[model samples]
Target chain A: MPMSPEAQALLKAARKHPDRPSDEARTRMRRNVMRAVSAGAGAVGATTAGTAAAQTLFAKIAGGALVVAALGGVVVGGRALFSSSESSVDPKNAPASTSTSTTVVGTSRETSEALGSTSTAANLDPTSDRVVASSALRTTATPSASSVASSPRIATAPSKPAEANITSDAASAPAVESVDVLKEEAALLASAQSALGKGQAARALELTNEHETRFPKGALSFERRAVHAMALCALGRGTEGRREAQAIVDRAPGTPLAERVSAACP
Target chain B: MPTPNALRSVNAPSAAGGVIPVAATRGSRSTTPPKTFDDLYDDHVDLVWRALRRFGVSEPGLEDAVQEVFIVAFKKLDTFEGKSALSTWLYGIAAYVARNVRRSQRRRPETPTEDAGLHLTSASDSPEDEVGAAEALRVLHALLDELDDDKREVFVLAELEGLTAPEISTSLGVNVNTIYARLRAARAAFEQAVVRRRAKDARQLQKGGLPCR
Candidate 1:
């Protein structure tokens, strides 16, 4: 007997009934949404904070470099020395004349003989020695001395602080956990697909049911429904399968699962 | 339903008409001290969920797509001009996200059984015909499972969503003519499947077996 138009229309309407989100489900979604938003906001804040801290660090490094360069210039300038004529000609300032002069002459002659073979001995003269001592005093006066002493300390500072901050920040950051959830959902979907491939409709349905329980809002739900519809079709329960597939499509129009549902029913 | 020409007029690029008036500049009014990410989620939660449903995104993928859509929107919110409705913009994002999900699924080698089309239209019926209509729709859904994703989408958007061809073209980034052609093919395919299913069920009933319906 030919089916009445009324029957066909009735079936369509029943299939079209919008699946309402349960209150508990809605509450969970609201929470998930809140969690996702918080995670996003935290990510943004962390990125901004990281950039600002890096800029401050770079500025400090540049300032320290400039100070080091200035100290280097002072050291180079102190090395070149030119004596005045007065120091060489002042007799009163010179060693005692005669016997004292003879003793001085003997010592000077011996010093010159020793220095003739070594330019290093010539630089060890009192004037040069005085310059070297003054240069050393100036080097010790600047922050460069402390900076050099603290180089190892500075090298370790950033890493130690960063490790601590990262630990604390990770602890404080909001957990979205979407990726993990998605992975689990994807795995279930894969298993369901595998079961369907093996021609085990019941197993497929079980996997889909599990997925539905865990991820009610998952796109996989529609796909699972489609699989159920296929199973129904195989069992000669085409009407029920068709309805389930239609519900999936109606609930999630553009999803791959909807396509699956539609195909199975067709 | 609006005629195609009328829809065209409504969607025409005009200085005053095509633009949806917004209550405030889309991103500028965020004077509420930057919302904790949680606040943004709360604000658009329903919008995202509804849009995903409208787009026919399935349950398993729905949450991820929802999260992605909002994240993308938040990151790019600064670029949103106040000219268009925020919901529309978000819907556009949801559509894109849903499409991407489908594409990724396609790349994997899956069983042929995984292939199913989406049914867009509800068979018209009075309240008195509810039960039978429901059964028929279930059959219809099963039949839809044979269609490819592309055909399924075209049918859903054009018939169920009641979006005009041009609107679908814009949403899917396809040519308008392509939408029309796809719709025609999808409808034909669906009708043929339904007729075959009905015939099979009738045969089974005549053979002393219970009709699956």
Candidate 2:
């Protein structure tokens, strides 16, 4: 639709003109760029560039000429190993897209899955996987009695305050007996939080589910539930999100966890 | 593979200054001096700065963002074919960098924007006009903020910056037709925003100062 003449003029009047950087700002930026360049960080786009630049600085400071002849025999011996690895890299120069592609969507499932596969062996059973967030009845010994006390029904409060109490209550709660498991689960839950922070809702969902499977009675239940609800909302499944939010509200209405879920899933 | 005529075309005077001396001096030397990152920076710094702002980078982050864009450009300059204008290439880099910064900021939500001076004016305007113009700019930015990132980028390029559809397509990495559709939605949204602002302003004028204050 064509904007009305008056509306067009209204917006046109406010159109920002090109910005001019102050001389100080320009000088500062130039100084920064020059510093980065002189440090040889600009040689090969990011990733390995930092390592290569460090190597260059090391070569300079160590007086390589003095040691080159002495080290020649060892260098020649290792040449085959270094040469094989170096051959895989393109010599034409670093590609611009190198740094661009490294950003993960939400959770890097590979890391989470790797952590899950290797470390999860010591984890509790995946019986919690059968526990749909909707069930609200499976109080099956999730170490957090504080959480079960709040609601035997909702999958909220998988993250915070009660997290420490989860360890204190661990002596009585036989389902989750070790503080080490709680710490490991907290770290895994943090990865899901990171993924959610990156707007990776699906990845967050996976990691949240993984946390539940590994530590169904995990301490960070509040944290994981909040993240799970937010992830659902972010993925546009608002009804599911609202249900989780309702549970958080019903279970722990005053805590930050409930507040976050209420705000997001609302 | 620029002909003398084509070289002459790009060498035409620019709004910022005179022609960028990249390919124009062709016949002189095979060493027509490969374009340095600084040359790209000098020629298109203003373009990068403005585009980044439109992409929702805060004023405080703009300086670091510009340097980051160029550092990437510096490393990747070897692969830049002249198929698109240098501004287009730089805009693409600036857009990606700005979007990433905004996404990262959203993830943390703790690093707050400290640049409240975005609407403060130098005495270039008379006292009366300064308030109105600054308020208008603030309102426009607020409305721009309400737009989705993609719509905001398209709107800023096409409407405010006067970039053509094809140019925006290249800059934003969208299909040309997609650019038009987005532009249409953007214009509609912008127009509605302006109308909404007018209603608010009309109601508030009776109460005195701009609502932006």
Top candidate (lDDT): 2
TM-score of chain A of each: 0.31, 0.37
Over the stretch B96-164, how does candidate 2's per-residue lDDT look in tens digits?
Answer: 777756765565435443223333222112223656555445545666776787788888888877778
Q: Residue-wise lDDT of candidate 1 within A78-183, one digit each (tens)?
A: 1111011111212221111111101112222232222111111112111121211111111111222222221110011111222232233333333334323332
CAPRI-style class, candidate 2: incorrect
Best by DockQ: 2
Q: Residue B195's C-alpha lDDT in candidate 2?
A: 67
Taking the tens digit of each residue's C-alpha lDDT, what string does model 2 give over A1-266?
A: 87765445435555533356776556545533432222121112111222333222212222222221111111111121122112222232223332211222222233333222222211111222211121111122244222222111112223334434443453343221221243355456656766776678899899999987876755445556767888899899999999987876776556545666777887
TM-score of each model, in listed order: 0.38, 0.45
- Clash number for every model? 51, 12
The TM-score leader among the candidates is 2
Candidate 2 chain B lowest-lDDT run of ten:
B13-22
